[model samples]
Target chain A: MTDVLTAAPDVAEIGRGVLVAVLLAFVAFGAIPVVAGLAQFLLIPMHAVRNHYRETGPYLPNVAVLVPAWNEAAVLTASVDRLMALDYPPDRLRVFVVDDASTDETPAVMASLGERFPGRVVHLRREKGGEGKAHTLNHGLREILADDWMEALLIMDADVIYAPDSLRKMTRHLADPTVGAVTAYIREGSEDAHGLTRFIGFDYLAAQAASRRAQNVAGAMACLAGGAQLHSRENLEAIGGQIDTSSLAEDTVTTFRTQLAGRRVVFEPHARVLAEEPAGIDALWKQRLRWARGNVQITSMYRHLWFRKSVHPGLGGFFFGVFWFAILLLPVAMLLTSIGLVGLYLLDSDLAATVFGAAVFVPVATFVFMITMTISVDPRVGLKVWKEALLFPGVVSFAVLTGATFPMLVPWGGGDSSGWTLFVYSWLVLCVPAAFLVRKLELTRWGHRLAPLGLYLVGFGPMMCAITVDAYVKEYRGAAMTWDKTEKTGRVSV
Target chain B: MSRGRTTTDRATAAIVRSLAARPYRISSPVVLTAAELAARGGVLPVWADPMALADETEADRLRERRLVAGLVVAIAVVVLLWTVRSLLM
Candidate 1:
């Protein structure tokens, strides 16, 4: 009778223990993307130490700036003019505009620029146009390598406007014998940049600029941004003079090759270029899809490079591994955690909410804090970036929606599985796209940022994942490696 | 199959074997960027490829590390669920 009296109370306590343990495991795996921010956090002290670029005067290498153009009459002339104005010596700086049979006035513009600048500008017009950016870049690279005098090569886009001193800063890194390639801070300068651009501009601060700074400490850089990547003659020769046509991510392949060859690829914050991103959601989707696809391609191409002794430890081993496991697996991990929480909720409602809420809030709160720290990389931009924090609610909602998936899924141990629980779980699962239902409201930044919150939900995370999935399937099916270029408007000003 | 095996390979193989023998991180997945921290912490270097053996003594430590981690996770999940069944259900 005494043992029976105590057993009743012990049962309730044990229920709580099971709930606690499962909830603990759910949070542990799910919150990885947020936790990955700690990689930058630890680098705070190291990054705080003053960054000093070497003197620009003596280190300037003869640079052949290659701009591959197709239907770029909109931005080519202004871009060429800006390139001409760059601080490097006129004799040292040669601009090659490889026109891939543009139907527009691009051919005419290229012809006129060549006539005006004479020897300074070279235009190679091709009859066929469908060949990708890599082929056009290769056409220029072949001639450049043949010349042998071109000490350094710059692979830049047609719409980007470079600062007068940008060449000097980017090229200086090549002076170090061990340094193979360098990329600059490519900032969006679109005058009519939609809210998508603002959010992305804010995002690039952490995603590109700040994150690269942290990765720089490990001698790892994930990619040489396509807009303003500079490469040394010898380094190009090591990887073959032409960029790899095997993958969509030519720059990323080059970055990996340089590291594998034991050369450092540096990301210089001081070297900046202004370029335009797609101002509309449709265009942004096309642009980001290509990038998403390319990254997936790079991961496949360099799958052998991860955590290998043959390659350097930085990009190949550590940073690329982080990008693969930490960043890419984010949505899947979060989704699983949500399912686990649902199972726990079936066990006990109040304890489930409390425990699940704790797991969800920590990463959400930590991510917001990470975004704030990332924005501080530029105080002027940082000021406007605080508005992005308002999206914190949307961010929190993301976690909640993720955790609420299959909310009625309780194993119930030996007990009969309840239909009511399954019904509730199915109902809760419908909220996954609930943001779309409210898209018309256009209440806050979601209306203005990236896409309407609903569309962004599909495009940014799930769409990117889907695109990667498709890319792998397509690659396995032997899809053509056509260089699909994102259309750039001439709206940006440096 | 490719080339002559050097002494450096043997030494690295010995070091990796020793490192693998050490204890694993307590609840490593909970730490999120645990791999990043470990890599940044300077304790883990770029080891040889998964397919390559440092020497006959080399245990392919990476495989062992991953195996142990998977087991821990599997055991934890099972124990948690089973305990819940015994205690509550």
Candidate 2:
């Protein structure tokens, strides 16, 4: 075998070609999202220079802000108080709180708010629950539509605390007859947020604020933020006033429908709202599963609409084809690439090392460039909350090590294959919702900074993949639709 | 919150459920073909309206600025990683 390895030059050339081919494939696939993402950096100047912001000098049409609460007793009164304090005409603005049969103090809070605001607030309490948010939203839509005096409908979550000027900022967009819907920028309010929330905060900054700003420059939106969605009366009527209640992502479907009806959806950056997110891993898992499932449902629902120019030129072509593809499938692709690199390493160690350097070079380079660009948008997180970004390299390094060991398993002869298999299997199983588990391990004598790496890998990779996979499984099983609400603590930091 | 269905999704899902739940055993190839057939429409757009963006020179200049910035950062990262690798070695 040694002589054979030293001898055959033709076979060696063939092997080199195969290895190079695999390496290139991995690079090319990884580059798709990177290129698309980097291309948005061109909009930095556009976002800076353009006068996208419009001053609302008395452009507030009679607006009805709809808040759908399931069991949101914690933050209902605070949210209602905030809504009452919006910088719009008190006579023109109305607040509607739909308490979807909450057993909590939500009904009482709504009642109190109703008493406080009197004519300005309408509290509609439904007797039944668990019908999902789309149904609850449709209930609000029906109630609001009955009153023609209301010109624009604002759909917001119970936990969303809009800035005083948020309504006015979002309201000005509807002055442009072409603008159908406007969505506000959502910020995580908790100052003392944990690791997962910090990562998610960074993600929101990059993905939602930065990316959508770029998409807005192109005169389209990937989707509107559900928490602070503002829809014009005419636009709502154009796409059928009723919210469709059989899929996971009502907002995404509505975004597509509005654009298909030839009205632009604006991402109002100035209109900022603070919304609470799942604090723990299990809560985050369930929340993300619903979202991932909703996205899947939208993708399935809009199969005929994707990339179709005649009906939805922007929504079909760019958002669904480019943005959605990158967001949903990139993780799976990266995971596959990781596995492939491992397999390649097992076959040819030298070639694998070279390929590994290339793999590391691409992502790290892209990430650095991206962070540099996106950080300019949110310097606080990019600079101050920088540990997550700093530890990312560690995550990437461990991912490579874990991946290389993966192919060592699979019963293809003996060795430490069993150990490799055990590590991989244990990681996959324990990694999801393992932050608390990891915290305990660290407290016990032997753990170190490796705990942070565990949080990133297990939190970002396995847990995220589990969300999407679970969503797909449920979809395949045709599980009944239920608005599995994320629990809120009413923890709004001023 | 979930449950926001389109008519097409509802219909397609119904058809899939019906076919899968049938007594007759379906071949893998047939099922795959049917699935592909269902996902057939949707044409891509080649030309998108520039959305009232008239200043080509400005866009080009901005693009150049971004390109230069990206190159600088990429170089810095590669250099940083190489230095670490050298130090380790």
Candidate 3:
């Protein structure tokens, strides 16, 4: 009986050791995103040394601009005007507006544009429309390709305003035969910018100006901006001469195909394209949900290609795979980290506190590094959206980070505060659901007034994570793919 | 000192001359005088101008330097904060 009692203690000790190890594993797994994000931000500076501009030349090809219009009369005329004003060889550029059976004044606008710029702007109407952007683009692609006059095809949304020099900058990369495709840096250009729009501006600065530069250095692009992706005729033919219509993310599929087919897809950061983003949280959620779901679809579709260098070097390598999954599986990682931290707290509060104290500095450093680097990329936008950038992780998380950074400042008495510690540990998991609640709040009349405040408090990062979680749920349920078009009010100014 | 050359044209000519290494020339017919090009249904090829391209390249290089400088500043700030925290602790 004494031996059995002694053995019980030993067994309990072993179980405790195993639990601690498992919790540590979870915490470590959660750190992957923070580490990966920091690595990506760090790579942005490397673009100064390693970039694709050395091979670029002043190569101006006969470019055909394809615009797929669906009830876009409000913005179509302005978009076409901007295209007409591009600083390219006027004779070399032709605008093809594929009118997808518009219920608005798109037909009249196109007719007027056609008359105003005869032989330059041609309108191709689709009697049967509303399939998706890919189908509409394919229609124009067919017509553009049929006439052997086009050397390169520029696929753009109906609402985007290309900078006068954006096309030339993009075409410069195509000067190198190895570069089959090029995407421009898309900026959020809302004339009367609100808090949400400002947040979007900062988001674009991080995603495009900062992240795409790193992608260029790494030689693996995630996706071509739908607003401004330029493709060589040869590349178009190589990738089956049409955009992939099977997935919501046709742009991503096309980008993946271009890379997989041994052709280089370049990101021209200097080529700035201004796009109108969704101004409302609900609208943004729906738009991002489509993109998020598309990413999920892409993850599964290209399951075989990841981490296999024989498939392709950059896209199949470990760095690219980690970066890709780090974003796609962020919510899962957050959940695991929260569960582990909370579980540890329940078992051993002191040990949990120690682990969290040490670990919190990583995210603090990363956030600082990432925000500074991102703002520096485009100081003009950054200056305007600095508040949004600072609150990007949400106000509460930012507070947590700040407190973690300077523990002396926080009035926790440097004593036992289990309640506060538990809240901090659980915040990671709670933030996602809180972000979803913010969206629901926007639907209520009075709550709509407070939604912006809620967004600021919860943070855009958590909201995006929430959207990603929604994408997973919808995808798992086999939800019908609906093309939810964001309403454009011609608010984008050059 | 061409008869029809404006002050802008003269400046462009001087800039072109300064670039003796590449010896800039308006080789494309798209770079013809605006009126002449407009008569042929072509727009002025401002993008093809050698001097403009060079200026853009210089600007891009400057931006890259700025990015690197910003990164250095960020790292320095982070290190300073860490040092202060360590000292305090």
Candidate 4:
């Protein structure tokens, strides 16, 4: 093994080429989203300046707010009480608490509220089905849309607490005929929120700010998150008010659909709501898995949307699919590529070492830029917290490995139990497509854990790590769909 | 308080069960605290409209973040590989 550092130049050239290729890829990946996002960001401000908050007309539309709850007995009454206290004109706004056949006293509480608020508060219930939130929401929408006076519907979660003016602020956007849906800024609620919650909270604000701004500029928003999304009754009926029950990311899919129909989905910055954040890692992981899975489902279902070449390709459907696929598959790609590069380098030290410097620089630069941007969005988390967020890539790698190895360990059953697997499978599918499909079939047929072997290797291993980073990035990227549902550790009487 | 369950308690149970069940469904709602509901009802109009307000640089900020994140992931992976090699050798 004569060390002939003689071939160093050749190795350097190859390494340089690899580095350039990687950087170009990274740039290509980052540029589309960045440009599209910036276009929206810049355009919205311009439009706002042009419009100058002029009230086009009076006729404030009536809103039907739907809060779908299950097993939230602990925080229900306070949530309801808060809901009942909304500031919209009683004649214009209606509140519906849809009970998904809770095995608890939720029915009684909803009943009591129905009694107290009468016409203002409507209570509806659903029977158990393999279908998830989509079924319950459809049931509610069918009933609410049946009423002609309800001009729009606000889709909310049980955990979200809307500001007094939130409904009113959200409603005004619908006055513009072009606007089909409106979603609001979600703020972090609890101070004692754990690390997971804090990360999610910071990520939420930053994403809302970015996505809404981007959408506003682009004139085509990606999604109206479930937290506090306001939908025009006309828009809902136009697109079939019943959400896609089969797809996981119904809100996102719906948003895309509305945008496709030539209607705009607005991301309102001023309209704010506070929702729960997951308290622990497990909860956070499961929650994210569901979100990621839902997004994948939507991406798959709307694969056709991406196929249309005429729309703004960068911000258009095609880019969305590519990004979705990349976002999910990238961690694995990174891991595999990194391994390959390193292995090649180790085998040929002079060659690998020569290229390493260039290969690493471009991606790192991009990472720094992303981190700086994320920190700017949520100053509450501060720069230091952003440093923590930087650790996300590592976590994502772990999640990727775990997901790849243990795709089937995820729950396949329908309903509440399915929620867990839905979450897990969502993450797993990103890294392990085959695993995801197998589990999808298994879970679709029955509701149980298939094998802990897949779970141990993928679900709990490097998959965990990959997921951590993915979650953090999603948070910072403002890509996360809902606020973390923080489990209240202390009792506070509101 | 016969401990039968306050409206709040019942509501909490309903919400939890609704989220945890198979269908993950819930009942249509009634306004419980008119005061709170009224307050929420009002604030929405003063602020929430995407078309109405400027994006205020938030989206650009997020795009920059993703760029940075991608870069960081690249570097970290490189560094990690370097560190492990250094240790092993």
Candidate 5:
């Protein structure tokens, strides 16, 4: 009986040790995103050395501009006018607007544009519309591909305005025979900029200006920007001659297919295209949810391709997989890290302190490095959205980071047993839900006044995490995949 | 009599002069002359010097190198501050 009693304590101790080990593993899993993000950002500098410009030439081909329109009367006129005024050869450059049976003034506007620009602007009307962007694009692609005149096809959104030199810049990449497609940087060009637009501006700068540069260095791209993707004739036909309509991310599907077919996709940062983004939180949420869901779909669709070098080196490599999943599964990582930290604090305060104290510096250093490098990529946009950049991880999380980094400045008692430490540990788990609440508040009567403040407090990163969580839930539930188009007001200024 | 310089030749000369002047200073290895541009039936934009584009890429490379150096220095300073604080504590 005495031996059993003594053994009970030993067994309990062993169980406790096992739990601590498991929790620590969770914490380590959480650090994957932070480390992966830093690695990707570090790769951005390597683009200076490993770029495709050397292989590029002054290759200008007979380019057909494909504009897929559905109730885009508000922006089509300006968009068509801008296309007509592009610096490329007038005879070579033609605008093909595939009208998806608009009930609005779009048909009338298209007729006027057709008359105004005659042969330059050809209108292909889809009587039976509402099939989505890919179907509409394929409708036009069929016509454009039938005529052998189109040496290269430029697929762009109806609302985006291409810079005068953007087409020439993109075409230069296609000068290389091996290069399949090129994407231009899509800058948020809202004439009346708000906090939401400013946040989007920073997001674009980080995602396109910084991350895409890193992808260029790595010789693998995630997706071609839907607003400005330029494809060679052979590339389009090689990828089965039609955009993949099975997924919400047709651009990504096309990108992956092009790369898999042994052709390179390039990102030309100098080729800037201006796009009007969603100005409201609800609108932004809808758009991002679609993107997040698309990512989830792509993740499953390409399950066979990841981390397999034999299939393809760049896309299937370990680094690319880590980069892809770090963003895709970020929310889950945050939750695991939070749960682990909080559990550790409850189980053994001293050990928890030791682990957190050691782990904190990496994220802090990475955050600083990433922010500085990302801003440096596009200083003009960075200067405007510096506050948003800093507040990306939320004000409260930033406070925690600051305190953790400099314990002397914001002392949380020598031991990590303080309420402040516990709060810090719990904040990661809380932030996502709080972000969802912020979005919910935006739907309320006093939303206009309070939502912006709430968003700032919750931070854009957490809000994105919240949208990702929503994507997961909706995807699991097999919800309706309604194509909620973002209403555009032609607010993009050159 | 020397034939009057066509628009293409003038444009080509202008491009050559611009390349020779000031910062560009480098002679073109592959001159995409305005005759070629006119043959393609496209007028080159005022800023569209194909050779100068290569120079711009080189300039961007330099700028990126400087930025990376700045990043390294900033990271070092952060580490130094953290070390100092840890020691003082």
Candidate 6:
């Protein structure tokens, strides 16, 4: 009778221990992505204070800009015009348009540039190699890497319209000698007018700004976007020029290689380029599937870098890739499972509301912090981004649908993006449903099987409506890297 | 036969190692020029004919595969446990 009297406190002590452990785990997960934003914010002032590129003007090297194109008639001419109008001296700047046997007006545009620029434009027509963008880029690099005069080469895609001073700003950073490749800020092109486009644009800025800022400070800038990148000839040769074109993500591998070879890469927010983003859900899914699978490919390729000394210096780059894969799977599962657990709790007690409120406070707090830091990057984006951030839960559900549906439809066996059909089908069918089901089950399980009521009436479910509303509200054409060609409104010089 | 072959190979390796370790204070342009000269050399090896080197590369690749396979098995065990828990839940 005496021992039974103190049993309540003993159970309370165990509950406290469990609560502390749960809190600690959630805190760790929340901090990983947030730390990246914090690191970038800290470095911004130091980068300004150091003024690393102050002495960069007088030592400008000859740069060969390679724009490899195939069937990009819609945007090729505007891109070439921007290239021609670059502020660098015509003699020092060499622009090569290697037409990958285009059946479109792209080849004609390249030919026309030759007559207009004379010696400045070099047109290389190559046979259609069924390989991919990476392969074409490698072929172009092979042609020019041996050219002793070309000091540094900027590899750019056809759809990328450079800011006139983009190369000029990027090159100054490269002159620091420690910096290997200077990748410009790639913004969404005007094609991003739809709901999906707006969400992608906002989410992209948040993710890139945070991730790059974090990695740059850690001395492990994982991957440089290939849309616009400046690489040194010597550094290129050190790693043996032109990445394994066979690699699904060539830019990511090259970024890792540059760092492993002891070269510092810094991100310049001022140097920017506008790119074409995917137009519809079909195209967007196809593009993101490539991106997702490519990320998987990279995670596989650089697995050794996670713990091996011989690999890249970025300690958690490979793990972060795994985290991205988890992002596609975890949220929905957690939500639904929590809902189920709550339902079970509600059945036993009248204190259901108290239990639910306590459990949800952690994710809500994390979401608030992410929103606050993102707004600090651009305060004007507060209400606009907040609305979109609110919609993130719904977008996540859609993403789950994308993640699960894609892999089953297009198994990874075909080897990279060359097999476009299977790749498109994977995201549309299997990955998409699988992701949605994860969320539905998580919500249903957590919400006592009233997931519909929970999603609509509860905290996370309302996020879907918020996301759709946010998408429509923020739907303005902006510049972002897209797989499809964008319809141009006006022309501005490079 | 073994003695002569070993002596000749060891001497050659020693000479090659010594040359490689030497600090050649050559500029980027000079090094590139030398590379260009070597490329134009009449006795230059054909691009695909380096069979022995390729064989050595393949052997190294095989070793890498074995190491990766061991790591994969360890990861697979973790995945299996996670899968079981997820399914049961």
Give the winner by TM-score.
3
**How do the residues A246-334 of candidate 5 rate in per-residue lDDT, one tens digit apiece?**
88888999999888776789998878899999988899999999999999999999897788754566887899999999999999999
- Per-residue lDDT of B1-89 in model 1, one digit per residue for the tens? 12233464455345445534544211111122455447547432111111121221122112223323323443454455445534642
TM-score of 2: 0.73
- By DockQ, is 1 or 4 better? 4
Model 4, A1-494: lDDT tens per residue?
24558688788888877865664454344344334333333333333333313422222567788887765677677777777677555666778878887777878888888888888888788868324677778888888888787777889987777777667666656666666788887766665654445556546744665445544544456678787888887678768777876555778878876765555677766566887776544565666666766665665565544544444333344444444455555555444444444444434544533454334433443444445444544445435355335543334434432332333333333234434322332342344433333234334435234422333233322333356455445544656354333354323321
TM-score of each: 0.71, 0.73, 0.93, 0.62, 0.90, 0.60
True contacts kept of each: 0.00, 0.05, 0.35, 0.01, 0.18, 0.00
Which portions of model 2 miss their true places by more than 4 Å? A1-27, A40-45, A54-58, A318-320, A381-384, A392-453, A457-462, B1-89
Q: Report clashes for each candidate as comma-separated counts.
A: 0, 5, 1, 119, 0, 39
The C-alpha stretches of model 1 lying farther than 4 A from their native spots are A1-26, A50-57, A316-320, A389-482, B1-89
Where in model 5 is the C-alpha error above 4 Å? A411-417, B1-70, B73-77, B80-84
Superposed Cα deviation of residue A77, candidate 6 (Å): 0.7
Report the alpha-carbon TM-score of model 5 versus the true structure: 0.90
Candidate 4 chain A, which ten residues in sequence have the lowest lDDT sum?
A50-59
lDDT by residue (A60-110, candidate 2, tens digit) is: 578898888898889988888888877555667899888888898887887
Question: For model 6, how does the per-residue alpha-carbon lDDT over A1-494 read when each residue is reduced to its tens digit?
Answer: 77877897988888866754454454344334334333343343233234334433223467888887777777777887888877554456888877877777877877888888887888887786446777678777888887897888898888888877677667756655566787876765554244445555556555554345444545556668788888878678866897766455678778877766666666655566877775433344345544544555666665545543223325344444433434433433343334433333334322332333343323433443444444444344334555555555454433432332232333442355333422322221233334334335544436435433333223233332223222222232222322333333333223
| Superior by TM-score: candidate 2 or candidate 4 | 2
lDDT against true structure, model 1: 0.63
Candidate number that wins on DockQ, 4 or 6: 4
What is the DockQ score, from 0 to 1, of model 5?
A: 0.09
lDDT of each: 0.63, 0.66, 0.87, 0.55, 0.85, 0.53
Candidate 6 wrongly placed segments (more than 4 Å): A1-58, A307-312, A315-362, A375-386, A395-494, B1-89
Candidate 2 vs candidate 5, TM-score winner: 5
- Model 4's DockQ score: 0.03
